[model samples]
Target: IRDFPTLMTKARICDEDGKAKSSYYKAMNDKKGKGLDRGKPYENKGNGN
Candidate 1:
């Protein structure tokens, strides 16, 4: 689980859900660096893609 301070930090950095999604996709698509893989799909269980 994530720590409360970390969650608070993210909340401060990403003011809206759209900003958070943008940051997430940017990190995932990064290459020649610490990019994450497009791993197995799972139930979103929440709004948006």
Candidate 2:
């Protein structure tokens, strides 16, 4: 849910339901967990792409 606003914005642009989707997901499952270590950027070929 960290990217909720951005997800909603993108969903609005694409005419999708991001918030409802995330809510449904959260409803069906627990949000607590070890989670991922996001200290580093999720790079994709960097600037050289």
Estimate, for each residue in 1-49, the C-alpha lDDT of model 1 and write its tens digit: 2699989878777678878898889877874454366543565746476
Name the 10 consecutive residues with the lowest summed lDDT in model 1.
Answer: 31-40
- Per-model TM-score, in order, reads 0.32, 0.30
TM-score of 1: 0.32
Backbone clashes in model 2, listed as residue pairs = none
lDDT on C-alpha atoms for all candidate structures: 0.72, 0.68
- Pairs in clash, predicted candidate 1: none
What candidate 2 gets wrong by more than 4 Å, as runs, is 1-16, 31-49
Which candidate comes out best when scored by TM-score?
1
